[model samples]
Target: MFEKRELAREHLKFENNLFAQRLVPWPLLNAPFEGSWCVIAPGTASTPHAHHEYEIFIAMKGKARLETGGKSIDFNVGDIVHFTPGTDHSIVNDGTEPFEMYSVWWDAPMAENFLKKHVATEN
Candidate 1:
């Protein structure tokens, strides 16, 4: 039923961070139906970035402040946020302890474009 896949952690690229490492994706969870968890160190911040996928995040531990398309939201533990393709977004750990969150993202069109743009030269 599935056409392509990438193991989260195996193929993870550094999303972004100023003070700590975050988002260790499991390659298997890179698909639209899959998901991953990222741990953010306190006082850390992620720079603005955009993806060609639909994404969602749920704060699992401490507070997480997120910005998207010039809008900001302070998410408490258990709060979930959704984002669409082409939207500029960023994340930050704004609580005392380390922050953990679940991320679910997928984009079929982007994957096709990526393959056409990069994999054509993989051989």
Candidate 2:
């Protein structure tokens, strides 16, 4: 079986953070391994929060300041970052260009709960 989904850029909001096309749905993937394409618009920053699951962040384009545990680091194209459970993190656009990324949440339920609870909020 095969499934294809056409994804477009949209706004993703969690609490007070704003994300563009963040936490995209991956219906094709099996459970316990769901993922989504994440995007951060220019001059935008995500809400600093922590998750109960492990997440892998892949940078597709542009650069941004990745903040974790009150520490900020610059990330650019082809960069990969990983966040474990209880690690507070957020991404902020440090340049004038859009930052694109694809992230995967190993814990499907945790990711779904967060995305469903706090997506579609406008900045």
Candidate 3:
């Protein structure tokens, strides 16, 4: 079983100058992980937030800065970042172009358990 979604048809939610679209866990897909697509306008940033789920962000376009753990990291197109559960983070777009990224998140415990089982089987 697989699913497909067209980006052009997806509705984007707006906050300030930031645009976001929920891609996974939608009505048709009851996935354990959640996913989203975001575009941050120049000089804008996503709200700093944290949750119980581990998160991965894959930069799709432009340059930006990732603020987390009291430090700022330079992020560019094609860069990928990971944040452990409950780590506060946000993406700041200081460049003239929109910072585009895809985000995927899932429960930390669930992921750990899955990895443990797979590793145990391999061992």
Candidate 4:
């Protein structure tokens, strides 16, 4: 058996060039498994931020220069990267193509607490 959940594309909110869509938003999942798809237009970059989640990225198309915790790594399609908690990270698309990736994250204690509150409200 399989769990089939279909969300229409129109429900996703993609605003601008450095767009991030919570492809499977935590709010929608109402669980700790959070994931998203980011599309960075050529010559744009993502804002550096840190969080409690262990972040993992899988490059699906184009290329990008990733800066994380004072180091830089250039990644192309099929590359993957993982950033630990509190690692300041950002992605830059220097080439003339859209850089897209799928990212997912989950926190242990923090995620547990957040989900507790989230599920409580939904109940």
The RMSD of every model to the true structure, in order and in angstroms, is 7.0, 8.7, 5.2, 4.3
When sorted by lDDT, best at the front, the candidate numbers are 3, 4, 2, 1
Which prediction has the highest lDDT against the true structure? 3
Reference-based lDDT, each prediction:
0.68, 0.72, 0.83, 0.79
Per-residue C-alpha lDDT of model 2 across residues 43-77, encoded as one tens digit per residue:
88877788788988888889898999878898888
Worst 10-residue lDDT window, candidate 1: 20-29
Candidate closer to the true structure by lDDT (higher is better), 1 or 2: 2
- Prediction 2 global C-alpha lDDT: 0.72
**How much is 74 displaced in model 4, in angstroms?**
0.6
Q: For model 4, what is the error of residue 99's alpha carbon versus the real structure, in angstroms, after optimal superposition?
A: 0.3
Those runs of model 3 whose alpha carbons end farther than 4 Å from true positions after fitting are 15-17, 108-123
Q: For model 2, what is the alpha-carbon lDDT of residue 13? A: 45
**lDDT of candidate 3 at residue 74, scale 0 to 100:** 98
Displacement of residue 51 (Cα, Å) in model 2 is 1.2
* List of clashing residue pairs for candidate 3: none
